[model samples]
Target: MTTANFVDRPATAPIGEDLRGRVAFVTGGTRGIGAAISRSLAWQGATVAAGYGSHTAHAEQFRADLAGELQGHAECSVHQGNVGLPDDCRRTINEVIEQHGRLDILINNAGINIDKIVLKMSDDDWMKVLAVNLSGAFFLTQAALKHMVERGSGRIVYVSSLAGEIGNIGQANYASSKSGLFGLTKTVAREAAFQLERAGKLTDTGLGITVNTVTPGYVATEMLASVPEKVIDKVKSSIPLRRLGRPDEIARVVHFLASDASSYITGQVWGVNGGIDM
Candidate 1:
């Protein structure tokens, strides 16, 4: 092609094709799975903005790490906020969109684990888990849905756990919130599909937005790093891969889902577990 033609090429023309010109916001994206997602998106040509409650140091460090990988590829930044509050979620995501002019992807990855039995679990326990895990996602998605609905494009993924599906000991509240998110995904898909079908917008048929979930199993991170050695050994022994999953592994899936390649998928739960759970 001529030089002028090349200059006029599409955004993903020079680089690889994954998520070019898209903007994404990730919650609880500092150093673990969320950071991985942020980095992956940046590498794929998506301008990524990550939100964190505290630990500004960690968030900035992640930004620096991604900045190196996405040089001349894409852009990324970190925002500080609490994902559990509707106002906080609104402020964080809206500001990003207001600045970027659009938000094409959202990863509600912040979650908490308050392990306790149902009988012994206080109301606060139940509410706290739900607030951060389920309610937080709800709030962000709620605000972003307007943009996605209006633009007829968006991708949203919730970072869940196998415990959300199979139910683990001392995680009744957590499981409940994660499971509830599944319903939210399905419900949004159903509603958005109905609107598009009625309007006959075949081009935007994937719910005007693709909503999905990613369930990870036994990831080895600083959070899990605190566990006793024996417990870690036992957990790793049960994995078919004989090891815990890395952050980048999960980030890879997030990249695929955020990209156009996963357009046909929605309202489904994908497991990043090492072949242990379906």
Candidate 2:
């Protein structure tokens, strides 16, 4: 419920110093919500590695941005690749582990929104969303999981949207991918907590990772640049806050999920929509 100003000294991580020296991997972390999450993690003393799809120039710029914000410059790098591909997903994790030696947190935030009526949507439109939104997360998590299981501690969060929870006028593909995340969160948590233990492979702390998803509603970002005026008007009027969420607002919640304060929370999907759904 705290508002943000987006400059100057940042607040401490909600979990205090527990996240110090941790390593975090964030997909689609070059801009928008992803960038905000990365910046917050850096502010909390975690090393962050981000992935991008189509913005090499922005990726290059982040190296400089971190130098100013993080004080010592980020010992990080960005890879330009499609998250939908398994090879690229693996490469993203491998690169992070190779550079940082450990992977403690993973934020699956890479997604594409191709708004269209179900009748008008093409196969390409549907498949593209599934590839990056669903498949990318599956690939990256599977690749990074062995390390997590071996270490028995990790955090994973997905960036979903309000549309997925309560449908929208012209976003079937996007909605499907986001809704799928709720299932992924619960299923992954159940498997780790139950099935792994029955198989005699999980220790009390070995598989104690927390996986969650954050669903944000109508955040201001490049993706919203094309939203119809009428739709924007309708959303703002309906929202109890009477305004759209900023990227950092959503990122702050993500920072909590990646830190120890959320140690008791897992497999939960939190909506950061300014109480829009409630």
Candidate 3:
């Protein structure tokens, strides 16, 4: 019998370098896809302030891991705040700007899902999902835009879902909130472009400030841990790749949108799904 050796591989190669000297704030940055994004940005030499709603231990662990991964090449810190709250959103953005002296990227990755069929969903379930997924992004953008517009440069990326692009079973509220992000991204992009144009800082290739969204599909995250095995199998079968998306796979796309390489990309939706909806 011959012994076989196996080597673990990262989902994607690390990319991006122009992020050095930049500051990024990511909501829900402690775990799952948000954690991957935080690590990705920091690894690229950006100062990252990761905001988490709760889970102090998880956030602390993520911060430690980020520091280890960067090994003094970047700065990564964790902040506690609830994106769903207006006051918290304002305060979080203010603190990040005050601490970093500038904000270059804002990634709205915080979201919650209260999955229930429309007939069984309560008003609270519907409103809470919208409050966190949709309104939270809106409020944070409003707060961050003031600084970005003043500087005439910024990047905003919203983490949407495939459920938003297409209807999903038992995700009425989640789907609606995610869908609202599309409108928000486009409107913000248009407004920011206009501002840059007036300042004579806009180029045909890119705006002074760019806004975009990343829609991930069936990612293997803690959020999916509760999903039934049968459902997971069914979803896997539906995907062309026949596997769940890794957080890093989604993070790489986000890293691109956050970096200077994607300056020409704005108001666009980049899907990181395993060709599930295609």
lDDT per residue, candidate 1, 166-219, as tens digits?
898889999989888889888876775565556565474453578888998877
Q: Which candidate is the best by TM-score?
A: 3
lDDT of 2 by residue, 181-263 (tens): 89988888776556446656556445367889999997877666667777777878999998888887888899989887787
Query: Which regions of candidate 1 are displaced past 4 Å?
Result: 1-15, 198-200, 204-208
Q: How do the predictions measure up, each by TM-score?
A: 0.89, 0.89, 0.92
Model 1, position 145: C-alpha lDDT score: 78
| lDDT of candidate 3 over 199-239, digit per residue (tens) | 78787655379999999998887666767888888888999
Misplaced by over 4 Å in model 2 are: 1-18, 195-207, 226-231
Clashes of 2: 1
Clashing residue pairs in candidate 3 are none
Clashes of each: 0, 1, 0
Question: Per-residue error at 113 for model 2, in Å?
Answer: 1.5
Instruction: Please name the candidate that would achieve the greatest lDDT relative to the true structure.
Output: 3
Query: So what's the TM-score on candidate 3?
Result: 0.92
